[model samples]
Target: MTEEPPIAVLTDDTAYAEAVQLAVDSAAAYYADGTSTLDDDAYDRLARGIQAYEEAHPEAVLATSPTGKVAGGAVVGDVPHTVPMLSLDNVFGAEQLADWATSLERRLGRPVAAWSVEPKLDGLAISARYRHGRLTQLVTRGDGTAGEDVSHAIGTIVGLPARLAEPVTIELRGEVLMTTEQFEVACLKRQAHDGTTFANPRSAAAGTLRAQDRPYVCELTFFGYGALPYPDDASEQAASLRELPHSEIMTWVAAQGVQTTAATPVAGIVAETLVQVQERIEQIATVRPELPFNIDGIVIKCDLAADQSQAGFGSRAPRWAIAYKLPATEKITKLIGVEWNTGRTGIIAPRAVLEPVELDGSIVTYATLHNASDIARRGLMLGDSVTVYKAGDVIPRVEAPVVHLRTGDERPIEIPQVCPSCGDGIDSSQERWRCVRGRSCRAIASITYATGRDQLDIEGLATSRIEQMLDAGLISDFADLFYLTREQVLGLERMGETSTNNLLAAIERTKAQPLSRVFCALGVRGTGRSMSRRIARHFGSMDAIRAADAEAIQAVEGIGPEKAPVVVAELVELAPLIDKLVAAGVTMTEPGWRPPAVPGIDVDPDAQTAPEAGGTSELPLAGMSVVVTGSMSGALEALTRNQMNELIERAGGKSSSSVSKKTSLLVAGENAGSKRAKAESLDVRIVGPEEFADLVGALL
Candidate 1:
C-alpha cells in the first residue's frame, strides 16, 4: 500500500505546516460546493492526528494547532455553529484513566468535590437552539464552527418540545439516535420494502438524518445533554455538583418540557463516578425499558463546574468528561415452530416460533424460517425441534433443526397446492413463486413476525395488533409498512402521532442498509445464521444467488446434499416474489462474507470434530442414552439431545423411551414414570432445574 505522510503529523512539523494549510484550502473547496472534503472516518482521523501532533511538538506545532481552533474559512453554507463543539481526546482502560484522574487531583490541589457520569450515546452529535423555549435551529458538529443547517429536520422530530417549562432560551447538544426497537423495525421495514439495510442503530439514524428527504428526518429521534440555563445556578458549585443528582436533573428537564437523556447520580470522585458508569453500561441490555434509546457507551463528566474549569478543555470537548462504550449484545435460543405466511412474493416463508427466551434482556419468541425448501431439506417437521440464536442482539434466528425423531406427528409439511391466501393456484419459476393473493395476505404475519424481534421489531405489536393489522387490511405485506401514512397508523385505537412517526422513521432509515441484510431479513428456511453467511460467501452477489441452478447451489458449503435441491427450489419459488420486492425497491444482496468456495460442502461445522481418525470419539455423554418422557417442553427433550449429541462428538448420546445405565440427562417430562426411576437407579445424570441452561451451554 502506498504510504501517505502522517497528515496529522505532517500538518504540524517543518514546512509540512504549509502542506497542511494547502490541504485545508482543498478542504474548503469541497466544503463550498455542498460536498464534504473528508468522509467521516478520514476526517476524524485527520483532525485527531493533527491534534496529537500539535500536542507533542509545542515548538513546531503552534498554540493554534488544527486541534485548538475552529475550522477556519471553510465556508460551509448550510448552518453556522453558534457555539463551537469539540471532540474529546480518548483514554482507554481504567488504569490510564486513573492516571488522568490523579493528574486532575494534582492540578486541583485537592480531591474532586463531586463528579457526574452520564452515558455517552453512540450517535451523531448535533446542537439544537431554542429561543424563549421554542425550537429555533439545528446544526451538525461541523469543524466546530459551521455546520449543515438541519433546522428543517429539527422541525419534524417527535419528542423535542415546542416550549420549555421555564420559557428559558438555550442551546443544547447531544446524540441523535434511533432506539434499538426503532432501528430493528426500520431494518425490517426496509428489508420488506426495498431489500436495503444498515448495520446498526447509529448508521440507520445517521443515514436517515442526512438523506435528501425531510419526512425521513422527521422519523428519526433525537436526545439531549448539558448545554445551558441551569435550573438552579447553585447546582454548579463543585461541592454541590458532587451532590449533583442525575434523577433530579432528569426530572427537572422533563418538567421543563425539554428532552433529556437518562443519567445517573454523581459521586464524589472520578474513580467512583467511573465505577458507576461501568455498572450502568453493563446493565444496559437489562435496562432497555428505562432507556430512551440504544446506548453503545456512556460519558462521564465532572458535575462540578469548578473542577471542570480547573481541568479546562482538550482540543475540543472539556477534559472534565469522557465516553465509555459497551460491547454489543449476543445470546442463543431455540426454534419450536415456523409459521408460513404468504407475501407480495407468492413464495411462502416459515417464521420460527421460539422457546420463551431472554436475549440481551429482551424476551424473544420468533425467527424467520427462510423458505419452503429450507423447511423440508433441514428435515424440519411440525414436531421436530431445532436451535435458535442471534447474530447481534438485533438479529435473532433459527440456525438448525433436528431430523432424528419420528414423532409421527413431526411429518413433512408443504405449501398448499393452492395458495392459502386466495386459495388460487399461481405459477412459480426458476427463482420465485407467484402470490395468488398477491398483496392481500402478504401482511398476514406482519403484526406478529414483523414486530417479532426481527423486522420493524415494534415492542408492542402483540397478539392484539396482529389481529388489528389483519382486520384493518391497511397493509398486505411488509412493504405496506413504508406506505403507512401517519394518519392511518394514528387511526389505530392505541397508536398516536408520536408512536406512528417512531415506527415510520424506522422504516425510512432501513432503506439505506447494505444488501446482504435484506436477504437475512427474508427468513429463508434451512438458512441458519452460518449458512446465510455461506450463501453470501459463494454468491458474493444477490444476482448470483437468484440465478444459480440447484446443482450449482448444492455446490456451496452449508448447502448440503438434501439442501441444495431445496435451495434451488427455494430461490425458484422466490424469484418472482423477489422481483415484486425489487419493483418495490428492496436492496437484496449477498451477506458480509464472500469467500471462494471449495466444491465439497461443510455442513454443521459447529458440530464437534471426530476425536482423531476413528477411536469412537467417545461421547462424554457415552452410555448415557436418554429417554425424555412427558413434557420436556421447558427442558431439552429426546429430540434436543439427539440434535445436541451431534454437537457432542463423544456424548454419542442416544434417545430412547426406557432409561438404563446408558441414560444421561434423563430429561423427565411432566408425566415421566418408571423410566425416570430406572435412570436414577442406574446413576444416570438427571439434568433438571434451571441448571439445564448451564449444562447445555457448557456441553454444547
Candidate 2:
C-alpha cells in the first residue's frame, strides 16, 4: 500500500497572504459562474486559515485581500445599488469565533462588550426598496455595487410584503429563501416539468428569484437582516451612538411588521469576552436543526452602533461583524450503483444507490438523481466517490462525484432505453424519459385512478391493495379489477375473509357507476371527470361516444379540435379494455342523466341535483358559467362552495374554479380577493353570498 504525500502547510507570511487572496478570487469566480468549487465546510476552513495567518502576523495582513472584501461579485447586475450589500467574513467553530472577537478588539484598541447574534440564513441576499410604505423595487446582491432588478418578481414571494405596515421610504436588505416544505413541492413540480431539481433550498431560492419570466408562482420568503436610512430614536440621547444597540434598531424594524431573525428569536448577547459569545453561538447551534428553513451559521455583530463605527468597514464587509458557520451537513460516499424508478406520469427518474453514510444525524443510503440531464451535469459515474447533501433536511441530493478519487474502472451512467417497470420503449421527446405505454403500463396508478372518489368511486381499494392485485395477476387492466372473485381476492397476501367480502361488495357497487364515471376511469388523453360528463351528456351513452368523430367531439366546450383527436385516439386504443368493462356488468349509460346547458356541472336539468325538493322549471342559469370565491356569510354559511356549484349546475349552469372571460356570473362572499377583481375586470356579473343563496332558494 502507498501512502499519499502530506499537504504542504504554508509557513511563510507572504506565501500565506497569496494563498488567501487566491482562495477569495476562486470563490468569487465560482459565485459568478453559478457553481461552487468548494463545499461550505472547505470554504469555512479556508476562511479560518486566512484569519489565523493574519492574526499570527498582523503586519502582513493586506488591505486588498479577499478576506477583507465580500466573497461574491455580481458582474451581471443591472440595477445600481443605493447602498452596497456587503458579504460577511466567516469563522467555523467556537475557537475561530473567539479569535475573530479578539481580532476585532485588537483592531478597535478596546474591549468588545456587546454583540447582536443572529442566524446566518442560507439564502440569496436581496435589497427591497420601499417608497412611502409601498414596495417599489427589489434587487439581488450583485457585487455590492449593482444588483439585478427583480421588482416584477417580488409579488410572487410568499412572506415578502407588497406594502409596508407604515408608509415610509426605506431600503431593507434580507435573505430570500424557501422553507423545506416549499422546496420539496418545487422539486416535485420541476421534476414533473422535466426540469432539473435544485440541489438545496438556497439554490432553489436564488434560481427562482433570478428567473427572467416574471410573475411565476413559488413559495419564496424574505427575512430582513438590516435596513438603510436607519430609523430615528428621538426619545433617547446617546453618547456618540455608543448607547444605541443594533438589537434595538432591529426591534424597530420588526415592530413595523417586517420579518427578521427576531421572529426566529435570535438572541442578543452582551459579552465582555469571547467565551460568552462562544456560549451564545453554541446555544444557537443546538437548536438550529429544528428551524423551518436552512441556516448555515450564526452572525455576530457589534451591538453598539458607535463600536461598529469605531471598528470601521472593510473593502467588502463590515469590520465589526463576523459569521460563525456551523459544520456542513454533507458527506462523501461511494456511488455503488444506480436504480431507476417509473413515476405515475411515466417519467423514468434515477435514484443513486450509495454506500450508507451518516449526515445530519441520519444514515443516508440513496439520493435522487432527478433526471439524465442532472446526472450528466454532475458528471456522475458508477464506482466513484460522490458528494451528497440534504436539501431542506428532507430530500437527499447527489451534488457531484469526486472525479479525482475515481478509479479507471468507473463506468459512465447510461440512461435506460426502456421503462424499468414495464419493459416498454422510452419516450425521449422531453428531457425526462417516459414509458411509451403511458398510463396502461402503470397498473397500480391506473387502478388507483379508476377507484378514485371522483371516478368509479370503488371503496375498500387502497393503493397497496391495487399493487397487491397487480402482483397476483388478479388484475391486468382496470376492467379485470371488477371481475376479481372473493376467492381470488382472498388469495392476496394480507386479505382475510372479511376483507375479501368488503372488496367484492365494493367492486359490485361500482357496476352501477354512471357511464360518465366509466369514461373518467378509462383515463383518455385530454379528458377528466368533467370532460367525461360533457361527453356522456353529448352522446347520451358510451356506444354513441365511441361512434362520434373528431369534429363531433370538438363541439363540447373546452374540448377543442386539437384535443378532440387525442380523445378519439385514446378511446379507440381502449376499445378492447372498454369491451371487457362492459362484459363485467359495469354501467354503460346514465339512465336519467341529461346534458346541462353548460359544461362541468353534475346537475340534472330538472333541477334535482341539489338535495332540496323543487327547482325552477325555467332553468334561468342555463348556459352560464359561474364561479364562487371567499367565505359565505349570513344564511348561506352552512353551504360549502361545492354545494353552491352543484346548485348552479342543477339550474343548468356551469361552475368554474377560475374567473375568466367565459365566467358570466361570480358568487362573491366575505373577504373575496383576486377572483372578485378578475371577475369585475372580465365583466362578470357579481352577486353576494346571500343573494346567491336566495337565487338557489327560488330555483329550488
Candidate 3:
C-alpha cells in the first residue's frame, strides 16, 4: 500500500476534482467490499479537503461531489430509514471541540442544559428494527436516507437480542464491531477455511456481518447508540420516548435487554457543563489504550431533547452532536525484514523490521511478531505492506499483511534452522522454538537479569563488564561471580586497583543476600521477583523448596498445578548451580520467614497469636491493595518500583499492578495517566507520593 498523502488545500479545479475522486473511491471500497487502501484518518483528511473546497467555491461545486452525502454518495439501498442515519462532524483537538460547543450554544440561542459523552466505536453503523419486542430486520447505513437489507445476519450477532423484554415496537441504531479477542478468533476461523487474513478488526466485522451461507461463522458484537420510533409504528410509548432526554433513552434501551455502552469504561454519561464534557473526553482518551475494543473518537451530544430540537440538523449531520477524534494508532508500513533474537528463557522470538512510520505520536521502526507461529498465522512476507499498531506504552505489533496490495516481488519469511545465539540445534517440540542449550544459550541475558536491582542487586556489575568477564573465562554463570578472585578481575581491560576492590566488595555483599533474592537471581522460568519472594517465604529455606514436589509447590500463594510442576522441574535443573552458591557461603534461608501452623500440632503458648478474621492488624496498611503510579518525589523520590512494592509489603499491604474497584488506594505522583483516571472513575482513594511516604514512613 502507498503511504498516505499530506492533506492540502484545493486551490484549483484540477486539485478539487482529484480530491473528490479519491474520497469517493475510498469510501466506495470501504462500504462495498469491506476493504480500502486509505485508512480512516487518511479518508477523513481527503473528505475535509473536499468540504473546504466546496465552502470556498459554492457556485463551482459539481453535482456528483461527495460533500453532503452519507458514505460519500458511494452506497445506495432500497430500504428507507425512518430518520436519517446522520454522520458526525469531526473536531481534532480541545480548541476545535470548544469552538464547536460554542457554535452549538449560539445556534440554540441559549446555553445547553446538559451533554452526553460516549465512545465513537470504530465499526459499521446499522439499524435493527423490532416489531412487538421481536427483532425482525437489520439494515446497513447506506447513504443515510436508505440502507441495504442485512437481516439474514440476525442470529450470529451478539448483544442484539431476537426478543426484547418488553412488547413494544421501536428502531435501535448502534455500531456493530468485533472486539480484540473476537477478531482473533474470527481470523483463525477464516484462515481455517482458506480465506485471506483480515486487515483489521473493523473490516473483519464488516465482512462478517454481510457474509451468507458460509460453512463457518464468525461472531459479531453490538452496542446501541440511538433509539427512534419505527416509521410504521404509531404507538404512544414510541412517541413518549422521543420526548425523553438522550441519557434516559439509552437507559431504557439497556433495561429492555439491549446492550448499550453501560458496561464499558467509556460509558455514556450526562454532564451539566461543557467543562465536564471535556473532562470526560480526556478521561476516555487516557484509558483508550486499555479498552478491549477500538474507539477512534469520543462522541459528545446534547442530552436534553429540547436542546437537540432547538439546535436542529444540517444537510449531513446534527448540529447538537460532534465527534472529537484522536490520532490514529494504526498505519501502513513495509515489512523490510525479520530478526530472530533469543529471549532470556531461550525462546527464539521473531521481530519485524519495518520502514519507519509515524504511529500515534512516535516513529516506529520495529514491531513484535510474537513467535514463528504467529508469523505463519499472519502469512506475513518480506517487502509486503503491513498494518502496524501502537497504543500508549504498548509494544508495536504487526496486525496483518495488506494482501490486496502485495506484489509478486514479496518473498516468504525464512525460519532459522539453528539457534541464533548459540549456533546449536533447535528443539521444535512446542509451538515456540527453543535452543537445545536452554538458559546456557542466553548467558548474557540471564546473568544481567540475575544482577538487576529487583533480584540479587550486585552493584557495579553492568552488562558490558559481565560480557568482559565471560570473554576472559572468569565467570561461566552468575554463581561463579561469587568465587572470582582479585587477580582474575585485575587481568581484564580497564580493571585498575581501586575498581577491582570495589567490584570484589560488591560481589561479597551478594553472598549475604536472603534466599528470596538468591532464588530470584536463579532466573526460573515461571517465577519473577514477586513469585520468588513468595516461594522463599513459604518454604523458609532453599533446601525445602528444592525438596518439595509439584503437589507441595502448588501450596504457594499464586502457583497453580501447571505452574508448580514447571517451577519444580526448573529447580531440579538448577541443582548443581544452587549447590555451588551454597558452598560459596550464600544465605540459604529467607529472613523472618515462619512455617505455617499445622492443623493438630502443639503450639507454644508464649508465641504471638494470629489476628482474628474481622479484627484490625497492627500494620498501618494491613489488608489494603495499593498501586503506585507516575514519578515519586520528596522522601520517596529515589525509590524504584520494586522498592515501593517492598515497602507496601513491609506495611502489610498488597502491591497491585493495576487500579480497579478492588484497589484501596493509589499513590499518584506527577503526570499520572490512565491508572489515575481509572482510580478516580472507580472512586478509589488517591494520594500524592509525599502522602504515601508518610503513610509508610514507619516501615521505611
Candidate 4:
C-alpha cells in the first residue's frame, strides 16, 4: 500500500512539567474571543511566526491557515460593491512605471501626452452606500468582487456620518491608513513595553478595521481611493437620481460625512493639476495625522466623465488611472566593512556594517551593501564615511557618507571582499560580489529577518534568543516554534508559566494568518510583501506554491533570476521544517477564511428592529448621529456605549464614534479626552446624556 504523506510530527515532550494545552487553549480563547487572552503585542508576534512556518512548507500548510486572508468576525452576509473595485498592478522602479503609462497610451491609440501622479495609500478599501438621504450600508472591500457587511463597524469611525441631509442614495469608495503621528505614538508604546510593534501604517489600519469592537473601529479613518462616476448626461442608474457633477458629487459625499480623495481640478490635466498631485506626495510627511486616514502613494485619474470612459480597463487595472507610490524610505551611513551573508536561499551578498543610527524609529546597524559597483559609487575606503538609507523606492541606503566624516578608523571594504567564513579570497565579475563558499558566510540575513519588525517581531526572540535556541537543540528552522515545550521554555532564564504561556499562546493565535505575511516572513531574497501577494494570488494554495518551480515564480512581475533562485532554494530547504511543524500540531489550515460573496445587504439586527425601537426610545436622537464623552454612571455608560446603538436604531438614527461637523449631537459625560477638545474646536452641538435621555423622552 502507498504510504500516506506524513501528517503528525510533534510528540508531547517530557521536558514540560505542565501540559501546554492550557496555554494553547488560552491562545484559542484570545483569537476566538478577542479582548481577552493574549495582549496585542504577543498576538502580533505569534501571528507573524506562524506565517513564517506556512511560507516555508506550502504543501503542509492549512486551509484555515492565516496565509493570504484578512481576519474578522463571522460576517452575517455579503454586499456587492456599487462599482466593481479593481486593484492596481504595482511597479517598483520608475522605468517599469513609465512603461505602464506608455502602454496605456499605445492601447488607446494615442501618445499619452500627459499623465497625473498621485499617492497610492497603503490601506484597506471600503464602500459606504446610502439611500434616500438616510445612512445605509458600510462594507469592507473583500475581494474586489464582493464585500462583508460592516455597518456596525462603521458606527465607530471618526469621520463618517450616520445620516445625510439630501434624500439620495449613493456609494463612495476609499482607502484607510494611519498618519505619521499615529505611527509615532504606536511605536513609542511598543518600544516602551518590549512589545511587537507595527511595521507600517497600511497594515496597521487594515488590522484595526477587522476588530469586532466599534470603539476600535473609531480609531480608523477611510478616504476615497476611487469613485464611481456618473455619465455626462446623468443617465447612469445612480446619476439620474442625483443631478450633480462628479467633482461636485464628491463634495456632496464629503458633506454626508465621508473623506473623499484629495484633488484640485484644473482645465483638463494641465500643468497646475499635475503639479498638485506631485506636490501632495512630497508633502505627505508633513500632513496632520489627526486629520484621519493615511496615504503612501498618489493616484492620478482622468477627471472628466467622457475622458474616463474613453480610457477603459485592461486585464488587471484601469487605463484611466495611474499611481505614483513613494520609493522605499532611504538613509545613508558610512560603510565599516563589507560582510557576506547567506539569505533564505543561501546566496551571499555584501552587507555594510555601520555605526548604529535611527530610521523612522528603529535603529539600523547594517544595509544591504549590494555589489562592488554600489560600494564604488559612493567611493569607499578605510575610515571613509558612507551614506545609508532605503534604495530606489525603498527605505534607507548606504551611499558612502560625506567625505569629511571619513577618519583613519574608516576603511574601504573590498568588493570581492574576503569570505566571511574562512577569510579566503572571494569571486565576482561586477554583478554580485560573493564568497566562493557561499554557505559558510558568517552573516545570516534570514535569521536576522525572523526577528525583524515586519516579519515575526517575536519578543524575547532576538538574535540572542535565536542563538540560545540553536544551542539547546530547540530549533534550526523557522517552523521549530511549533515544537517548543513549556518545560523547555521555562528552563530559559526569566521564562515562567506566564511568559511561556504567553509565547505559545501567541503561536496558536497566528496559526491562521494571511499569505502575504507568510511570504514576507519567508524573507525570500528580493521578493518583499507586494510581490509575495502576486505569487499568492496565482498559487492560491500552499501546496501549489511549494510545488511550483523557479521559472513559474519568476513569471510574476519584477521576479528576476536574482530573486527566483532564492525562493526556489528556500522552498526546497523548508520541507523538513514544514513536516516538523505539522507533527508538532501547528494548525495548517485557513480557519474562517471565506472570500466575499456577491454583494447584498445582510439583515442588520438593529436595522430590522429599528423602526419600532426608534419610536419607543431615544426620542431626542431619533435619526441623529450622537457622540458621548467623559466618565459616567452605569446607566449613562449603557446609554452612551451600547444603549445608544439600540436607541439610535430604534429612532431611525445611527450613532457615530467621534464628534465632527456632520455629528448631529454630542452626549457629554465627564473627564472627556481629545474628543471633547476637538468638539469644542469644531463648534459641534453637545449635550449631557441626562439631557439627551430627557430630549428623547420628550420627542418620543
Candidate 5:
C-alpha cells in the first residue's frame, strides 16, 4: 500500500506559527468572497496537524491559530449578532469522537447519557430572525460575531419561511445551501449565459445568496439546525424553550413550518451512550452520498439544554458538541504534463494533465494548477506524484506534490515563452501570463459572449455550434456571424436542414433586437447589459455613442472617467465591425428610449404636479423610497417580496429592504412585523396593499 503523506508539514516553529494565522486569514477571506482558494480537505488536515502540535507544545501555540474558533472573518458588514454564533470543533474518526465524549463525561463528573446526531451541512451559515411570525432579517454568519444583511434575498430561498405558522419572535440558525440537482441546473444555465460556474453547491449557494443581480437563477435552499431568541423578545420564547432537548427543539421548529434536517433518518436520533453516538455518526456517513445536499460531517450534541449549559465553551467552540468529519474523497495520481490555456480576458492559466484515476465516483484526468506563482509556491515538477482532490467536492485541484516520491528524472515546470493557443509571445508583466494578441487570440470566447441572452439574445447560437463554425473557418469574429452563408453553415457536421434554417432564422431575428442588446453584444470593455441599456438610453442611437468622445461618454450615468477611455477605444476599434453589422440591417437605435431622471439626483421643479407622484399623471412613485413589509393579499398575494421590489423599481422608485427615517412610503401587508412598527415610529407614510396597487398598479 502507498503511504499517504501529511497535507502540510512545517519544520521551524516560527514558520508553523505563521502558517496557522495565514490559514485562518485566508479561509476567512475566501468564505467572504464565496469562493475557496484552499481545498477544505487540505485545510482540515493542516488544522489537525497544528492542533496536535499545540497539544504537545502548549507554549508554542499561537493565539491566532484557527483551532479554537469558527474559521472565517467579519468581512461582510451587517448588524451585530445578539447571541454569539459559535462553531463546532471537529473529531476526524470514531475513536476521536469517543475520546471527546469520554473527556466530556470526565469534566462533568458524570456519565453522558444521551446525544443528538445531525448531519453537518457543507454550506454557508445564516441566521434568519422572524419578528411576530414574519421573516424580518436574514444574515450570514460572518466571523460568528456579526453578519451581512441578506434580507433582500430571503424570498428567493426555498425551504425558508416568509412567515411562521404561529405568531412569535425567533432566530432560526441554519445552513444556506443548494442541492445537487439545483447546482447542475445552475451550472448549465451559467454555461449558456457565459457566466462563471461555481466549484460546488456550497459556493453556488453562497454566491447566489450574496449576489446583487439574478440571484433567483441559482435556486438556493435552507436547512435549519438550531434557533435562538431575538434580543428584546428573549424572555418570551427563550424561557419556555430553555430546557428542551436539542432534537426536540429541531422538531418543534420543523412543526412551526421552518425546514429542518429532522426528516433525515440518522438525524434527531437519541443515542444513549458514546458508543451509540459513534454508531450513529457512522450510519450518517454511510448515507451521506445519497443526501440531496453535501454534508462534511456529523454533529453530536448533548440532548438536554441543561447539560449543554454545564458543558461550557472554549475560546471559540462549545464544549457540549463535537463534529466528526468524514474522510475526504481524494486519490493519488501522476503529474504527466502541464497545458497552458488563454481565457477571453487573455489571462493564461495552467492545467495539470494527470494520469487518469477514479475518485469520488468519477474519472479525474486533469486539474487546475491556478498560475505560475502558485506553481512556484507548490514546488511542482513534471513527473512528481501528487495528491488530487475536489476543492469543494466539485472543482478538481492539485493539492501538492508528494516530495518523498520525487526523483531526479522529474523536470522543473516553467512559465511558457509563448501562448499555446495563438502562438504569440506571452505578456509577463503580471504573475499570470497573458496572450499579447488579446481578444483576437480567444475568438470563440468573444463570440460566446456576444451570443449570450443578455447580449444579442440570439437563439440556438450555443457554444458547441459556435466552435463548429469557428473550427470550420466559417466565421472569424462576431460580425462574421451575420455574414455566414446558408450553404456554409450546412457544410458543418450535424447541420440538418431544420437546424440550418433555425440557425439562419435566429441570426436574422437578431437584426431587429434593441440597440441596448446590440451594444452589449459588441463586447465593449467594462460594459454589461445594464451599462449598455444606460448608454443606449442616454444617447438614443448607436451612431451618437460611436461618434462621442471620452468626456461625452463618461457623462452617461455609471460610466466613469477611467472607464470612459476604454469604452471609447473599444468602440473606435470596432467602428468598422459596427458599420458591417448596421449594413446587414441590424437596428441601430433603441425604440422609445428615454433616460428616466434619477431620484434625488435629477430633481424636477414643476411644483410637484406629477400625477403618479401624488400630483399629476405619469411615472408612479417617482423619487420615492418604498419599503414593502409582510405578505400582500388579493391579486398580488402570490408575488414574492423580491418580485414586489422589482415592481417598485420598474415604477420609477427605490425599494428598500429595511424601514428607516428616509423611507418615503411603507407598504404594510398582512402580518406586518418589525419593519411596519419602525415605519410607524418614524412617522413614515403607511399604505395598504390597495393603496400600493394604486401607486405602482397591479400589473405584476
Candidate 6:
C-alpha cells in the first residue's frame, strides 16, 4: 500500500501557537455558521501539526487547542444531547488500523466477534429526534455534548421522513449531506439568489442545513449511522433497539423510514476478520469517486452490543470504532491564469494554471478548465480561489470558483479570438472552440502522434525533429515525411550525416507498415490505435475502408452509431493525405486480416481467407474482453498501451479501457491502484504482466 505524505510537525513554539489559533478560528467559523477559509485537509494538517508540537512540549499547549475534543470545543449550543455525537479517531493506513484493532481487542480482553464497515460520509453530523414516529427536531453536533437546533431544515432533507413507518420514539444520529447533483443545483440556486457559490459539497450541505428565510431551498440527504432511545421515551422497544448490535440497529433504522448506507454502493458491511474489514475498506475506496455523495473515509466499528459496552467511550470517540482515512481528492487553490492549447483535432481547450496545491498525493499546478463556455459557466477568473477536484488517475478539473474568497483584483478570463497554435480565425460556433485551420493548424502535433511507436513506428522522428522539419517547410502533413530527400533532411539545423541517414531510414521504414499502423497514424477523431486496428482488420484494405459508409463502418466491434459517422467523415477529410501516402508507396492492406466476403464476386479461395472462416478461434485469448492497467515489466516493458492493445487483438481478445462486469480479464501490472481493487471487488480474473506475457508469448 502506498502511504500519503505525513503531516508537517510544528517545531517552533510561535508557529505552533499560530497554527492552534488558526485551527480554532476555522473550527469556530465552520461549526457556528458552516463557513471556513480552510478546506478539511488543510485544517486536518494544521490540527495534526499543533498536536505534534504539543506532544513534544505539553506545557506549551494552548487551552483552545483542537486536539482531544469534538468540534474542537469551539461551538456551544442551547440544546443539550442525551447521548453525545462524538467524533471518530482516524487511521491513515492499514498498519495504523491494525494497531488500533489490536488495542481494541486488548481493551476487550478478547478478539471482536464482528466488525461493521461503512463509508464515513463527508457531511455535518446531526441527531434527528422523533416523537411517536414524527420528526420533532433536528440538532447539529455543535460541541458533541450539546447541539444547535436546526429543525428548520427538517422538511428539506431527503431520506429522513416526517413520519416513520412505525410509531416509535427515537433519536437517529447520522450525516446530513448534499449529493453531487444536489450540490450543483444548490450552487446554481445560490448563484441565482446572491451570485455566490459554495466551495464544495460538504460546506454547501452545512450551509443549506442551517439556512433559513431564503427565497430558494436546496435539498439535503441523510444517512443514519446509529439509533438510540429518545431521552423522553422509556418504551421497551426503544430500550431493546439500543441493546442490539450496531448493524441490526442500522437495519432497524432503515426499516423505520430513515435512510442508512443500505441504498448506496458503499453500504455498511459486516466483516468477521480484520483482513475482511480492510478488503471492504479498499472496495469502498475504489468506488468512492463514483458515489453520489462524498465520503472522506471508511468507518469500522465492532458490531456487537457487548463489544461496544466492553470497549466503552474515549474522551472524544468510541474505543471500538475508527475512521480509515482516504486521501483527500479536492483542494482550494488560486487560479493564476489560463492556457489555451490546441489539440490534434484543433479543439482549443482551456487549462487552469494553479498555485501549487498537493492533491491526492500529487502536486497539482494545473487543472482542466474544459472550454470557453465552461469558464463562463463556472464564472472563473484570474486570481480567483477555485476548488480543484481530482480522483485516481483522472485529470484534475476546476469545479468552481470560491466566489466568497475573491478580491476586487480578480479579472475575467480572456477568450482567444484567433487560433493559439497558428494565427488563424477562431470557430466559436460550438461549445468547444476550434481553430478555423482545424488539423492543419496543429499539423506538427498530428504528425508527431503519427510517428509514435504504436502508429507508424517511425524512429528518429522526435517532436523537435518534426518541428524543425515543419519550420524548414520540408513537411506540412505526415504524408510529406516520405517525400523528404537526404539533402532536404541535411538542411535542418541539427541534422548530421549519420543522424540524417537514420532519419531518412526511419521514414523509409514507415512506408512498409501494415494498414492498421498507417490508419492509426491518420489520427481520426473517434479512433485510437486500438480502434484503428479494429477498423483496418475489419476492412483489410484502405480502399475498402474509405468505400464503406457509416452504416457499414458500424459493423466493426466497438464502432457505434455516434462514432461511425465521425470516423467516416475523418477518412473523407483525409483523402488528399491518403492519396499522397498511396502515391508514396505506403502499404494499404493489413498483413493478416481477412476482409469480409464480397457478394456476387468470383473470389480466388487461396488469395485471401474470409473473416468468417475460423481464423481467430485458434488464438489463445479468443472471445476475451481484456483490460490492461499500470506499468508493464520484463519483456512487455518496451511496449506502450497501444502496442499492448495490438497484442491483445493479435491473440484474439477485445481490448477495453475500463473495468466492468463484462471485463473477462485484467492485466494488472505494478502499482495498478483503483483498477486492480475494482477488478478484485468484481471478482474479475487478474494476471501480472509477466504472466500475461507468457500467455501471449507467441504473439509478442
lDDT top scorer: 6
Instruction: Write down the lDDT of every candidate, Cα atoms only.
Output: 0.54, 0.73, 0.86, 0.52, 0.76, 0.87
Q: Which stretches of candidate 1 lie over 4 Å from their true place?
A: 1-65, 69-84, 145-149, 179-218, 230-247, 263-273, 281-296, 325-700
User: Which sequence of candidate numbers ranks them by lDDT, best first?
Assistant: 6, 3, 5, 2, 1, 4
Evaluated against the true structure, the overall lDDT of model 1 is 0.54
lDDT of 5 at 281: 63
lDDT of 5 by residue, 1-700 (tens): 0112254666668768877876776577557654544456667667767777787778888877877766566365567888878788877666677678889988888977688888888888889998888999998888778878988787778888899987888889998888878887776676556433445566667777888876336688888998887556647467777678888888889988988886654455788877777666655655554467788878888898878988898877899998777755555678999998888757789999999876554688989888997787667889977778663245688866655456779999967889988889987876667788877799999889888866776888889999998888878778888898989988989898999999899999999887877898887877876577668767868878988999999998788988998899778878888988988889888654444467778655552223223321255866788888878987668776645764675566667766655899999998886566556545789999887887676344
Better of 3 and 4 by lDDT: 3
Model 3, span 1-700: residue lDDT tens: 0123346588899899888777787788788656787777777778788887888998878877877776635787789888999898888887788889998888888898989999999999999999889999999998999988999899988899999899878899999999999999989998898756889998899888888877888999999998899766667887789789999999999998999989987898999988888788878887788788999988999998999988999998999999888888898889999999998878888999999987877789999998888888889999999989988788999999988888799999999999998899998887778898888898889999998888889888899999999898888789999899989999989999999999899989988887888999998887987788778767878989999999999998889988998898788889999999999999998765556668999767344333222123667788899999999999888889888886776576778888766899999999888789888887899999888878877667
User: How many clashes does the backbone of model 5 have?
Assistant: 5
| Per-residue C-alpha lDDT of model 4 across residues 522-608, encoded as one tens digit per residue | 665567654555565455445667888888888766688778876887677566655665576543432212222347856444422
Model 6's TM-score against the true structure: 0.84
Name the better of 3 and 6 by lDDT.
Answer: 6
| Deviating ranges (above 4 Å) for candidate 3 | 1-15, 56-62, 231-233, 537-539, 548-565, 602-618
Name the lDDT of candidate 2.
0.73
Error of 5 at 364 (Å): 6.8
lDDT of 6 by residue, 155-273 (tens): 89999999999988788899999999999999889878776677788878877887898899999999999988866567788678768999999888888888988977788999999
Q: Given candidate 1, what's the lDDT at residue 393?
A: 36
Model 1 RMSD in Å is 25.2
Which sequence of candidate numbers ranks them by TM-score, best first?
3, 6, 5, 2, 1, 4
lDDT, candidate 1, 563-652, per-residue tens: 787767667755655665676665555322233435896645333233322233333444445555555554354334323323332233
List TM-scores for all candidates, in order: 0.41, 0.48, 0.93, 0.35, 0.49, 0.84
TM-score of 1: 0.41
